[model samples]
Target chain A: GAGVSQTPSNKVTEKGKYVELRCDPISGHTALYWYRQSLGQGPEFLIYFQGTGAADDSGLPNDRFFAVRPEGSVSTLKIQRTERGDSAVYLCASSASGTGGMSGGYTFGSGTRLTVV
Target chain B: DQQVKQNSPSLSVQEGRISILNCDYTNSMFDYFLWYKKYPAEGPTFLISISSIKDKNEDGRFTVFLNKSAKHLSLHIVPSQPGDSAVYFCAASALRGGSNYKLTFGKGTLLTVNP
Candidate 1:
């Protein structure tokens, strides 16, 4: 793919329901990342993956927020028992490498807007 | 605590004039800084970046200035155009070894360039 792709561009889920957001990164991208942005705030880092392994999950808000990059090409963000406070945009980004030395910068997908009602 | 801060919520500038967006950070460990532009319903696009080793970086119409002592950075757009109107976000990364290079971002400043 020429860019990162995120599924369910918009999602409206009821409180306590589970929602899953998917991201298909660019071909051959070795690093994948997930971020969440609330209204009037910048994107907040959630998790990061290097290959099929999660190199950093320290940013995950809590146990309800989880993400996985099983095949290293596509990733999924799962929110269990979603709350109203969880309503926001979930973004996915990919970079050529996990190192900051990659000059080009990370490519981000449009993102999935989740509305927890 | 907001490690990164964009105090100004909005900025307006006339076409052909320089538009400056400001940002400040509290974390001195951050070694890389980046700027991104975003439109409604769209994801942010990378604009420019500067390494801590350098005080200034320029690319075409965009320039980023970093002041390590003050933990401040600013993005300047030369001859601002209406098309440049968008929300601009400032991000910083520590670039720690074996880390995933996570970025900390500011609240963002909305730049409105009028023609």
Candidate 2:
């Protein structure tokens, strides 16, 4: 793919409903990330994946949010018992990065706007 | 414990003038910084970035300055245009497990260019 792609551009779910958001990063990108952006704020880090294992999950808001990148190419973000406060845009980004220095940039997806009512 | 902070929620600038958006971070351990521009209904696009070793980096109309000592970085857009009217976010990343891939972003600053 030319860029990152996120499924279900918009998701409207009721409180307590479980929803899954998917992200397809660049074909060969090994580093994938998930972020949540609330209104009037920047994208907040949620989780990052290096290959099949999650490198950092510290950013996940709580036990309700979980993400996985099975093959290191595509990822999914799952929300359990969605809350009204969970209404926000979920973003995905990938880069050809392995370490620090003048490296490549991250390409972000259009983002999935998840609205919990 | 917000690692990055963009104090201004919004900024209005006249077209053809310079627009400077500032950001400050609390972590001295962060080794890299980046700036991204985002429009409504679209994801943020990578604009410019600066390494902790460098004080400044520029690309066309976009210039990013990093002051490691102050834990501050700024993005300067020359001759601001309506096309540049979007929310800008500052992000930082640290090395972990032989890679620095995760990024912590600030609460963006919306830049509106008035003609």
Candidate 3:
């Protein structure tokens, strides 16, 4: 792909339902990251993957949120028993390398706006 | 605790004027800083970045100034245009696992360039 891609630009789900968001990063990008942005707030880190393995998951809000990058090229974010507070724009970014100095920083997707009512 | 802070929630500037957005960080270990601009229905795009080693970095009409002593960084847009109106976010990063990848972002400052 020419750039990072995220599916389901907008999602409206019932509270307590399960939802999944997918991200497809740029070709050959070795580093993938997930972020969540609430109203009036900047994007907050959720998780980062160096390759197929998650290098950092400290930013995940709680056990209800989980992400996996099985092949290192594509990733999925899974939410269980979603709450109304879970509504937000989920962003995905990818870099050629894990270092910003080398990859010139991340290229982000348009993001998936999740709404739980 | 907020590691990065953008005190101003909004800024208004006239076209052809200069627009300055400020940001402050509490983390002293942050060695890299970046600025991103986002429009409605779109994701943030990298605007400019400055390494701690350098006090300033510029690209086109965008210039970023960093004050390591104060843990502050600012983005300046010269001859501001209506198209430049967007939300600007400041991000900082420190080396982790031999890489500077994780970014801490500020709440963001909305810049309105009135034509």
Order the candidate numbers by TM-score, best to worst: 1, 3, 2
Q: Which stretches of candidate 3 lie over 4 Å from their true place?
A: A101-103, B96-99
Give the range of the ten consecutive residues with the poorest summed lDDT in model 3 chain B.
B94-103
* B1 Cα displacement, candidate 2 (Å): 2.5
Clashing pairs for predicted structure model 2, backbone only = none
Each candidate: chain B TM-score: 0.96, 0.96, 0.96
Q: Which stretches of candidate 1 lie over 4 Å from their true place?
A: A100-102, B96-100
Per residue, candidate 1 scores C-alpha lDDT tens digits across B1-115 of 9999999999999999999999999987788899999999888898999989999999999999999999999999998999999999999888653342688899999999988
lDDT of 1: 0.91
DockQ of predictions, in order shown: 0.62, 0.56, 0.62
Candidate 3 to truth, TM: 0.97
True contacts kept of each: 0.53, 0.57, 0.54
lDDT of 3 by residue, A1-117 (tens): 998899999999999999999999999999999999999899999998999999989989999999999888899999999999999999999998888432267999999999999
* Chain A TM-score across all models, in listed order: 0.96, 0.94, 0.96
Q: Cα deviation in Å at residue B78, candidate 2?
A: 1.1
Model 1, A1-117: lDDT tens digits are 988899999999999999999999999999999999999999999888999999889999999998988888899999999999999999999988886323556889999999999
- Which residue ranges in model 2 land beyond 4 Å of their true spot? A98-102, B96-99
